[model samples]
Structure formats: C-alpha cells, structure tokens
Target: MFNNNKLALAIFLAVSGASLSGCGGGGGSSSNNNTTSSEPTWTAGVFEPSSEFKDQCALPRTGNDPYNNNQPYPDTAGSEFTEKMWLRSWSDETYLWYDEIEDNNPDNFSSVAAYFDQLKTFERTDSGAYKDQFHFTRPTEEYFQESQSGVVSGYGINWAFISNVPPRELRVAYLEDDSPAANVGLQRGDTILMVDDISIDTNTQQGVNILNEALFGPTAGDSHNFVIRSNDGTEKSFTLVAGNIAQTPVQNVDTLTTENGTKVGYMQFNSFLSIAQPELISAVNKFKANNIDELVIDLRYNGGGLLALSSQLAYMVAGPANTSDYFYYQTIENDKQPKSDPYPFIDFEIDYSNFEATNTSLPDLNLSTVYILSTDNTCSASEALINGLKGIDTEVVLIGGKTCGKPYGFTPTHNCATTYYSIQLTGVNYKGFGEYSDGLVPSPSPQFAADVKGCELDDDFNHQLGDNDEALLSAALYHIENNTCPIVVESSSAKQPSFTSQAIQETGLPLTIKQPLYKNNMDLTRPLPAKEGNNE
Candidate 1:
C-alpha cells in the first residue's frame, strides 16, 4: 500500500516501511549501495517503462517486517520498549513506494537491534537489494539534534588523506572559516605529518582507521598535537584543540577572468543546507556583478543535502532562460492522482538561513548554460540540480567522473529517540525522465546519459579545486575556449582511486570528515507561485 501522509504513517506502525544506508555522511539516498536492477521481461509482451523496477529489487526473502504484536515485548524490558517504539515508527512511516514493507519479516530476530539490522533489506533502491534501508536510531542525543538544525560537533577540518594506500599523507582539503584548523593557520595544501607525535601514515591496513580515530576522536574539545608541512615543504608542529566547530556548507567561491579573457565563476558548494540558500545567492550575486561568461560548480565530493537550495541554485544558474520552465517533477507509486507534478523554477527571495516563512525575489545569474564539476560522490539534490538544469535546455557540461546517481529524496520523521528518513519520492526532469539508477554517465548517447555538453575527466590533486588549471576546472575552462573536452589524461596526480573515498570499496571504516547532511523541506504537493512582475 502506497501511503505517506503523517496520519497514515502513524497508523502503519500500529503496522513497518524505509531510505539508503550511507557511509561518512547521512543521506536518504545512501552511498555506494546501488545494486543493478535487473530489467524484468514479461512474457505477455507488455512494454514496461524505466520507472518501474522489478528485477532490481529481487532480494532473497530474508524475513518480513513485523507490524503487530508478533514479537512479545516484555513491558519490563526497557530495551524491548525502545525496540518496539522504533519498529512501530519504521512500520508507520517508511516510504514503500519503491518496495513494500511487509515483504521481509523480522520474526526470527531476537533483539530490537538485531531486528533493526535485519529489517532494512527491502528498500526498492532500483539497483537491486543492494540498497539497504538506511534506518538507524541514534545512541546519543547529539545525532538527533544535528538532524533538525544541521549542526555538528567536531574539529571542523575538511581534510582528505593524500591516498588510501598505507603510509598515507593527510592533506587539508579546505577548512571551515571558524574551524580549529583555520584558527591554527592550516591552509589548503598543508600536509599532516604527525598526530600527537604519532605518524599520520601507517604501514598496515589499520593505519588509516587508527590515524582517523586520533584525528577525529569520540569527543570534541580534545587537544591533539600535529606537525604540518606547508605547500612550500616547510614543516611546523603545533597543538590543535578539537572543539565544536560549525560546518560551512558553502565551502569555496571565487570569480575570475581566465587566461582567455573569459569571465568565469567557480564555487565548491559541498551541501545544500538551509544556510546554503543565502550563501548561494551571495555567490551568484558576485558572478552577476562580474558578468560571468561561464560558471563552474565543483561538486566532486558533495553527497547532497537540501533540495530547496538545489532548486534555487538551478534557477540562479539558468536565470531568465528557464523562468517559466519546470525544474523537476515528483512521481509517486500510487496512481490515484496525475502521473506527475511539476515543481516550477522557484526564484523567490527566501532567507534560507533562518528558514523564514516569507519569500523574496531570488537573485538570478541568467546564464543560458553552466559547467558543473562532479564525481561519484555528487548525489541526490546535486543530481537533481544537474537534471533540473537539463530540463530547461541549459547547456550542462559535466567535468570529472559520473555522479552518485540518486534522483531519490526523503523527508525525515522523528520517533521516540530517533529520526527515520525513508525514500518517499523520486524526481524527474521536465521531460519526464527520472530513472538513472545506474547513474548518469557523460557520453554522446542521449539514451544512456544527460543530453547536454560534457566530458569525463578526473580530479587533479596537485591543484586546488577552483584553480584555473585544476583537472575538472580546466576542462570547464577549455570547454569555454574550444567547446570540447581537453585531451583526457591517464589520471590526475591527485586521483587516488584506492584511497578512503567511497569510490573505493565500502570497507565500513570511520572517516575524519563529517557525515553527509540530507534533507528537503519544500512542500512538494504545492506548486510554486508564478514569477512576480516582469513576465519577460
């Protein structure tokens, strides 16, 4: 039964339902868990569209989700009480549009933790059962708090290891403006040689995990010593106190004139938190002032967050070119209503920082086309941004590798002590295209990829992301010059495929970076108001 209203979700728990299990970040779409959905063929000669996935969700029946008092929850046992509460919430609210809940039973599971573990095998993820439902209760209150406000506790360093290989060299990717790393003058390109006198690299497999723990310990405010090597090869050792640092979703922004005299704007927006809307507006405003000839958004590592901001960014990029066009469409399993609903370009002036009720006219760049930098980590709302732009016929030139392939989205529901995010809806562009379960690959074939300009380039570790000559950024600049890809390289010096990125095998290792932020607060059922004033 496909039902997701708040009341229905509650009644179901009194039934069970679900989203993606992700690593290093929190997202409803989960990461690196796509199992190829086998396109099922029907003997009846019925033509099935890409939207339906039967072969992909075929998982060997493990067990079904318990909806009733199938398991005796001793009232005396606090664990049972907690487990029951969780199970009920899962049953009540999980979005079963992709895969039905009762399909797998959890009767054999002995404990609530074990039941929860066994229960997520049924998400419809379209990639097959590889999409394990990412439903977990927080053991601590901090996680619950972070869900609502999008705030996190950590040293606020966005560092990436030099490589996944042992004897790894840790480098600072970028730092939050007010993070401890920034306060200590740790700039990008600085390498960490030691953590509290312990070497940053290890000779064994556990080396990375061990180094990670030291860098990101269990508690904030923990002081650790470090020796960092500057870009000039100068080594300086200093002590850094890891404390609660506010994460800045808008990581980097710059506007510059390229060597060819083309005005280009560059931004590396990592997440789409509510705070990002204003920051994004600020970035676009700068580009507007500069009259950028081309814009580059480096989302090579972004796992995505809010869709509202993603929509706004799309609108900002496409500007007047797509003023009346639809950014994307929402589709549900139940067909009682229309086939799909259009979410038009909302260019409202909104104070996303405060989640204000009122709306204002959003600033627009009005560029007819855009160049985006991506990798396997670019996902959900990020993918939506790419598709949304494509929907309006904006020229989308993709540089770097393929994206995380997630048109899936979710709205978080809070229970006793945990927040459950189930994949309630999937998005399609204005053309009614949605299923990129295998991800949108950049190629000449419009059937297999997004129909726009693009190149498959790797990231350059030697240069900064927004640098004029960076691997992905360079391709964008080249596209502006020759309108084609630069000669593809064997690989970038910064391309460390075997490193700790999820692009490597999902080894379930702890990461020094903060977990992903995923949420979309837009009221999907309602259509956006028409553009104000100037119809032109």
Candidate 2:
C-alpha cells in the first residue's frame, strides 16, 4: 500500500486557510515551523519510515502535467531533506542487499540523487565488478516516455565498444531502419573515428565526456559530424542530426535453410520493450507456421525491458507443456511485505497499452532448444529468457560472448519527479538457481547445470545480422547440425577489432554509455494476472 495524499490536501490547504490534520505525513504543525530544531534530522544508521516523506518535494511541480493528460502533478511541499530521508527508508526496506549497505549520513551529501547513489553496497562480484551495477535513476517523465512510447532522441545507432579504454574503438553494431544513422548509410561494423571534432580514441577525461555526450546525450534537432570507417576500410564523413526515433524491437524476421535442409527461424530482437509484444507474437506465429526446427534470437544488443515480455517470449519458445511450471521466483528483503507468487509462463496476450490481459492465446513453437546470440549487452530480461527456458529443460545454446550477469530486478519507485531503480529483488528459476552474477558463459563443458552449452566466440560485425554467414549465427547453425561447437577462427578484418576478454569485462561503465538508466533492467513494473499456487 502507498501513502498517496492529494496535493490539494497537502499543499493547497495552507492557502485555503484550512486546519491541517497531519495530511502530508507530519506536515501539519511540525513541518510548518520555521525553527531550525523543528527540521527533520538524520542520525547515522537510524531512519524514519519512508512513507513519512513520500510525495514530499522541495520544488514540487505545479499546474497541469504535460505527460499525463493535463492532470496535476502529485507533488506536495517538503524539502530536500525529506526527499533524501524517503530514499534512505525506501531503499533500506526494499534494496536486495540492504544489510550490506553502508549507512552513511544523508546530510553528508549535497543532492538527493547524489545521496541516493551512495546507498548501494560497495561490495564486489567474483570478477571484481560492483555487486550492484544496475543502481541508477532517471527523470520520471523521460523513463516513462521510452518505456511507454518506445521513442527516443538519438541517431538510431546501437554503438558497440570494442574497447572503451584508450585506443577506444567504437563501432555501429546495428541501426534502426529509417533512422538518421541508417538514412546516412551507416552500417554495422562502421567504426566511428571521430564524433564532431573529438577523436573516438581520445584518452583525456574532457574528451571522453565530450565524446560520450556527442554519441549518447543528444536532443532532437541536434546535428553533429562523424567520421566513419566502413567495414571495407573506406572512410567518409557525414553530418547527422538527432531526431525522435521509434525503436524497432524486432527485425530481420526470416527462416533460413541450412545445407542439410534444416529450417531455422531467426529474428533480431533489440529490446524487450512493450512495443515488442505483437511483433514477437507474429514472429513466433510465422516460425510455428513454417515448422522451423530451431529458433535463434539475436539479443546481442538487447539490454532488457519488461519482465512479462520475457515470460511471454519464454513461453512461446518452450510452449505450454514446458512452461506449465514457474518461470521465475523473485525474493525481496525480509523486511518488506510478503512476496508475490512465482511468475508463470505467460500464455495469453497482454495489451501493453494498458497492461491488461487479452483473450488472444499466444503462439508457441514447442521447440526443445533455442539458440541465443549474446554479448555482455544481453542483460536482465534477455538473460531471463535464457535462464527461464533452461529452468523448463529447454536447451539454450548461447553463441558469442558471455551475458551481462544481472539476475536482479526492481519495481521503478518514484519520488519528487525522479524514478529511482535500485535492486529490489533477485530472481531465480524453478530449479532455484540464480547465482550467475559474473555472467552466463557459453561453454562447451558446462561446469554447472545452468552454464549454457555453446561456444564463446567474438561478435561478428563484418556480416549483417540474420545472414547465415554471421559468426554467431553460423556457429549456432554449426552446433545444430554437428551437435558440437565449431572451431572459432579469428577474423582478420579490421572492422572486427580484437580486444581481450579482460578489457571487455572491465569496460562496464563505458560500455553502458549508449544505454541510459532504464535500458538495462528487468523491470518488475508490468501488470500480471494472479495465478493460483506457487509453482515453486
């Protein structure tokens, strides 16, 4: 339950000359006092309940809400202190590793967002990476704009960092069709030599910041010049203006025939966005109609989106018999309310517009195995698909690099016009295994049952995705026919810049430059019907 008090009762009551009855969480008399001692104080390791500060804002937005059909913003009068206190209490109660957090005094920090950033655990993974790398926040309206409308301001390029460190190599992994980048003839494997005038390989901090902004942080109608070296080693300059681009979640849907006459269904899935629901359904329907022997989902660049979409995709891959059991079980902190039931494989369609269930039964392929083209970019919900399928005894042959190890998720929490996404839950499969924090590797000799079976090969950028000749796809095809991974031959093309696995692993923050806060996540905010019984 949420302490949702109207703004009128909390803020307008003062102007209306009405007696306040503790409406805005102790804002009646104590909050109205000008005395310094009356202000809320913070003691190290001590916290007041978050509800006491919920909806309290220092600079609350007034007037009609442009994002919500001219509705009033649900913000009340408070201070920055109350906002920080809310974050501390909420995070303490719900953060998956609340006990591991260092309870620093919130007053020590200058800004609310800055203080909220320090609340996560400073622990490391086995590979020395931050245990909670997914902690971040976004402007509430910006987060909803992308999640709901699937529109973003960009050049429509998914930039791949072969190396984010100096001698930094940035290349175009893929492009949304009809976008500025595609319209300018930018193709996959085209390395960006320069953004504006800053060289992509610049080692200076100022240059890196400039490069990051030029490539990732652009507004609509912004123009910049780029020097690109194509796969054929031809360099050219082009001016691209950023615009509002709607993402194409699913693309290159086709059925490929191997030399042995085995039909394989392949589709490049970029994001698990709400806009992807119908596209995914239709792709599966086509695959089912074609009676494809195997399915290959290219998620090398899919950061992740809604969890319900992940469940739906898993169901479609494994079909009813395999998905009758639980798909995933999420565990929250014990201090929070009772946990919900394990999410089962979604069999029916969902109207993502309103997040309501539909009578339309989803299409399924009933395949026992699926080939997933992965990379470190294959994160949260994408990894969920692999783990969920493996839980139900379906084979997930991962070709290419290891997945971004994130079995974590959170319900996006809103406070003071900012939506904070902290790790609230860690999800495990029906087998009770979710410890792949380092990442799920493509191994020929899988050490654990959850370790995927396939080859650890480099991402093939020289060839277009869905082409049978692409390294990852070709490897999947080879494994399908030969029942074993083929020997990986290093490509000699300069477009396929070689980087050590360690370098790639260490480039986590830099790699996420193109992807914003909400892009890489298993958002637990999707509405699902309550199914009876815990499948666990």
Most TM-score-accurate candidate:
2
lDDT of 2 by residue, 208-317 (tens): 77888889988899999999899899999999999999999999999999999999999999988888889999999899889899899999988887787888888888
Q: Please give the TM-score that candidate 2 achieves against the real structure.
A: 0.88
lDDT of 1 by residue, 374-493 (tens): 876677777888887777778788887777666665455433234444555666787777777556666533455543458876656567667777777888888888887778648435
TM-score versus the correct structure, for each prediction: 0.72, 0.88
CA RMSD of each candidate after superposition: 11.6, 8.0
Clashing pairs in 2: none
Candidate 1's C-alpha runs over 4 A off are 1-93, 97-114, 122-129, 132-150, 161-170, 191-193, 197-210, 228-235, 325-327, 333-340, 351-357, 444-447, 450-452, 491-494, 499-514, 517-536
Residue runs of model 2 more than 4 Å from their true location after superposition? 1-38, 326-335, 491-512, 526-536
Worst 10 residues of 2 by lDDT: 7-16
